[model samples]
Target chain A: MGVLKAAWWIARKDLAVEIRSRELIYTAMFFAVACLLIFAFAFVEGRTTIRNAPAGILWITIVFSGTLALGRTFERERQAETLRALLMTPVERPAIYLGKLLSLLILLGSIQVVVVPLVGLLFGAPILRAPFMLMGLLALGTTGFATVGTLFAAMLTRTSSRDVLLPVVLYPMSLPALVGGMQGTLWIFAAEPNYELVQTWLAMLVFFDAVFLTLALWTFAPVMGE
Target chain B: MKLGDRLIVVLLAVSGLMLTASPYVIDTAPYEATMGLVQRIFYYHFPMAMTMMLSAIVCGAASAWFLFRRSERADHIAVAAAEMAVVFGVLTLITGPLWARKSWGVWWVWDARITSTFIMWLVFGSYLLLRRFGGAGSEVLAAAVGFFGMVLVPFIYYSVNLWKTLHPSNSVVPSLPTSMGIPLYYCWAAFTLLFVALMSVRIRLERSRGWLERAYRAVED
Candidate 1:
């Protein structure tokens, strides 16, 4: 219960910061929108390909926007050594992780709200069919990605090239999320009942999250040693 | 006394040379016209692909170790293993495409195996690039990437088994007759040794370079 309180405090603090600045949400939305606009125009000569390729463009935008948000989010901790200070508290490592991850979900989820609509408008697809499953998969997939990515961000924070290295490694690790998320979204756009595929991919994502998240917990103490 | 590792190295060097010249020395059944002599690229290409996968696996294991023990040595080994993987990856990519060009009309295809392999390479390569700029203790960074890259490899290999696959079937694995399997295993063993030797040498070099950097810094201090 105490750990939960600490976790809640951290989450609230992060939300408060974002609310005050509003930079994280606004910038991520802009990049996502701009990506769709550019991809739409670039494939002007190939409308057939564009129709087929909107899936790729949509994913590309989410991935890039996710990276941007993740980098800046961690960069905040790095600048202030906030993660280290957080460690000094009595919270369980996983609680801190879960808390930060929940806040990340909120932030990235907001970006998705704007990004998904923008994608729906540009791509002209029926993405709202089975809305709960669609949103559930996205949430699961992004949580898995952010869980591992945030762990790496913690490790790389002490390094000099944190910015470049984080994405290079983080993006690769998140391929399952990329595959599962894209496939789920594709199903949503197809307006078909593919809840089975959604469950299977979500299972894959949960497995990945469990394994890597444990690894991060085991290393966090050593990674941020006193 | 057991023969020193260098003996193994010399034996490997000799075996590689022989495999390189096997077609001229032995008069086996003539390869089909379409494949011809170029088909020998198959021997090198398959082993290189196997070795690249092996390298990624090593990186993954080492990464797991780093995350577990937080030993700098494990981190160094993980990073070293990943660096070694690049050469094998390049060899596979180059020779596989070359074989493809000869086998099919085009230089590349959108086949599952090829795509997955290419994606794996990008993942590892990008992971390495991240390490280069990640400053000190970059191994943890690389390990995270390596571990994740490995997750995709089994899917790539068994993708055919999972789906009604269309790519070229894997012929080099078990269940082949001895004539082909023997030579193939010989070549596989030799290439794996070559990979180990390369990794050892590279790891030594990296350690020395780090030592030199630290020594210079201490002198200034």
Candidate 2:
């Protein structure tokens, strides 16, 4: 089978299963909302919210819920012993990786659909300031996070202590993405937004996505082949 | 002794002698006009940072080799380099704060260079943890982590430059007077040799452990 075709089918399979069960989306979306409420309580004093706190809070919620969702997605595969069978398929290994990444992007994208606006409502972030720009940054930033996150989480599926190990390993490596996302959003939320500076950050995010996606694709085969 | 053993001995002796003489060399360098005596910590601190960065690169390259080529020797070398990165990273982190407290008048700041170095240390520390706890077949996983950690160095570097920074710029080294620059380079060379010596010993230990494991399997069979 062609690589892209196989990848699409694998992604479709995951989405189809998700559509039937509604397991990951429902839980992850609730988890993301709960995460924001907690942050809202902590950062929002009776009437006023901390300056620039919403940007950090928004990214943190996405990452935290994303981590939970990433773990459970693979945990389901592991529990059913389906991942091994998936590996046994005739398609190339990168197909499996791309498929997994595609599904994760959709899952995290859905969570962001809910979480982004909630941050606006709760923290008064200027989400409407540059709507397209905000979405672009989130898309690039989420891609950066998920590229590395998917590679590591998938490789970690066979391990015993994945839940603990995932964050320990994932957070440090993805620091740049987190910093970029938060900073870009902060600039957008600023009283006087620096569109030029935000564009530079967006460019950097693009660079990050390119480098890590190439790396994740290159290493996925070897890491998972074993 | 085998040539590898002899080389390790020689490296250890030379590195030991250089490190012992480093204090006197640093003492002779003139004090900075601004920071005074606190600046001398730069002799060790700069070298520790250099060693840690080099060790991280080595670990990453070795990890890539291990992952692609499936070479056990590369894995051992990568593991040893990771340990060195951690050791020197701790030294860098500690001495940095001490220097910062006196020089910057604060214990820590979110300076670009300092934050990037801290993140690097965390990455290597996580590398060690993954290896220790990742169980069988973890070498491949840890190798992937090491490669990613190394790849992050430049990205963090570039992104940090976009932010405001309090850390002294990299130009501080190239523009230094010969007296201070000499001592600084001397310490760097000494620290590097020490890294090599320690890595050799650690790699040897891993090699023997592998042999012992294979022997145990053979005997059981």
Candidate 3:
């Protein structure tokens, strides 16, 4: 089968399983919203503080919630005999990767859509103007997160302690995407875009995607097989 | 000693001498004392940072090689690279704190550079931690660690930038004034050689250990 077809199969398989049991996304959404509420009250906040703050809030929420979903993504596969069957197929490995990452993209992207606006609404920091830029930043940021997250999700699949291990390993690693997205998101909110910071962050985000994607491709077969 | 061994020894000795000499020339004047006598530590600190960074990269590379090739040599090289990384990583942790105490008043700040390096220590340490977790095959663990290893660099880097942190981004390797920059570069060169010397020795020791383990297993079987 073609790589795209394989990816589509994996993606569809994951989606079908999730739709049958809305267990994963529900938990992720609950955790994300709850965490945002906590961050709102738990931290010091002035109107001015909230003004430059929505970017961080969104990325932080997405990461935490995305990880919650990602940690569970492959665990169930291991628990059952499903993954071994998938591996027995003749499809290339990167297709398998793209498939797994695509699943995370859907879950996290959905949660992000919900949480970002909620952050704006409750915090009274509405996203004005630049909706396109904001959405693009989210796409870039989420892609970087999923790219790294998919790799870690595979790693955590076999380990006894995948839940906490996922965040511990993933959070510190995906800082660039978070930073890049945060900055781009930050610019989206401002009256004037900080052109230099925006460009630098965008470049870093893209560079991160290229390098880690290659590294992941090179490393995934063994990590997952073993 | 063999020629290769002697050259390494001589190079290490020369580097040490240069590290010692830097303070006298640059920080000699009574006024130039911020990173002064203590700043002389820059000579070693930069090299240690370079080695740590290099070690992390090599760990990632070796992780990939070991996974794809499934060779014992790749695994050993990776473990060796990680051991070397830990040594330099420790130096980074220690010297940065010392420099911070002297430079920033507070020894540790949740700054960009500081926090990122700390996270790297955790990540690298956890790489070693993987060897202990006997859940599955060695190949899997190596692949997992390799896959995730280098991902830490960006997060550690941009963490501070994302949230406001106290660590300044001296970026470990921006251009420097010739007076101080040139000596620092020598120190870097020296440390690079020193690290390779250490890696060679460690790789040899590791190979011996691997042979011994196999021999023991063979006899038992």
Candidate 4:
């Protein structure tokens, strides 16, 4: 099979398994929701604070729960010995990385589907005001997250303490995405949203996603090699 | 000890004495129009920040070399540099806030420079953590983290300009009067030498540890 075809097949396999098992998505959604509620409880001094400060809270929730999802996804491959099997195939390393990234993006997107709207409902955030912008930010930020997260997860899979190591490795690297995402979302939810600021932050997110995705793809082979 | 090691010891002692005398030297410098005596912390704080950043670059470069060449020497340097980064990073973290408390009227603020520095510190801290706890292939993983962290520095440096942060910009450096500037440069020199001395010592320690480990393994086998 061609590289693109191989990547598509791998993504399809992961998504199909997720559909059958439904474990990752359900747990991720629940974890994200729980995080959102906890943030609301801790920070909601009044309605105004909740409405105004949901940006940071929202991004934090995504990061914390996204770490869990990435860990679990890789854990499946490790536990089933499927990662080794996949490697034994003729697929290019970058193709495998691309495929894994696609699955993670889908999983995170699904979690955001529930989490974003629930954040709006709970925090009274006017997130829907610029729904397209919010979606753009989410896509860009989550792409960076998954790109780096998948590479690190695969690198750490053989280690015994991967669960702890994944976040330690991923969080610091994901700062630009987190900062851009939070800042853009903050501007979007402002009383009079600053289109200029939102645009600038979105541009940053785009840059971060491009750079990190390329770097991850370049390094994936070396990192995944035995 | 060898002559080279003795020279390093002498260099370290002089640097330590110079660092100790820096407070008095800073006090002798004319008080700033704005910040006053509390600004003395600048002598140490700025140098620590510079050293931290320098160590990060060293670590990142060493890590990249390790990745490319798979040299155990490169790995040792990377690990040593990372350890120095953490030490200086912690000093920077503490000294920065102390200065901020006096200058900005708050102990901590999530402004751009401070935020980025904190994140950089955590990144290296995590580098050390992974090396300690990650079972195998941890060096490679840590190298990856080091490379990524280095790549993130420009972004962090420019974050202040990108956002409306209260942290002073690069403008503060050029505007320094001669009295203050001289002392600052002296501190910078002292700290840079100190950093190199410490790093060399750490690298030697790592080499010794690696040799010991191999020796033990051979004996056991």
Local accuracy by lDDT, each model: 0.70, 0.89, 0.72, 0.84
Rank by TM-score (best first)? 2, 4, 1, 3
Model 1: docking quality category: acceptable
Q: Point out where model 3 deviates above 4 Å.
A: A44-51, A191-207, B1-34, B104-123, B138-140, B147-201
Checking candidate 2 for backbone clashes, the offending pairs are none
Error of 2 at B121 (Å): 1.0
Per-residue CA lDDT of model 2 for A67-147, tens digit only, reads 998998899999999999999999999899999999999989998999999999988998999998899899999998999
What TM-score would candidate 2 get against the native? 0.95
Candidate 2, residues B1-221, lDDT tens digits: the string is 99999999999999999999999999888778987888898999988999999999999999999999999999999999999999999999999888887766778866778888998999999899889988888889999999989988888776776754321344332222345478898999999999999999999999999999999999999
Over 4 Å off, model 2? B165-179
DockQ for every model comes to: 0.41, 0.61, 0.34, 0.55
**In candidate 2 chain A, what residue range of length 10 has the lowest lDDT sum?**
A174-183
lDDT of 1 at A5: 80
Candidate 1 lDDT over A81-143, as tens digits, reads: 786787777777767766777788899899888877776676765557667777877787787
TM-score of 1: 0.84
- Top candidate, metric TM-score: 2
Report the poorest 10 consecutive residues by lDDT, candidate 4 chain A.
A46-55
DockQ ranking from best to worst? 2, 4, 1, 3
**lDDT per residue, candidate 3, A1-226, as tens digits?**
8888889899999988998999888999999989887778754365444456666777788888888788788887887877787777788878898898888788788787788789778765546556766777788788888887888778667677667566766766676677778877776666566655655566767776777677677666767763
What's each prediction's clash count?
A: 0, 0, 3, 0
Model 2 Cα interface RMS deviation (Å): 1.9
Better of 1 and 2 by DockQ: 2
Task: Report the first chain's TM-score for all candidates.
Answer: 0.88, 0.98, 0.91, 0.96
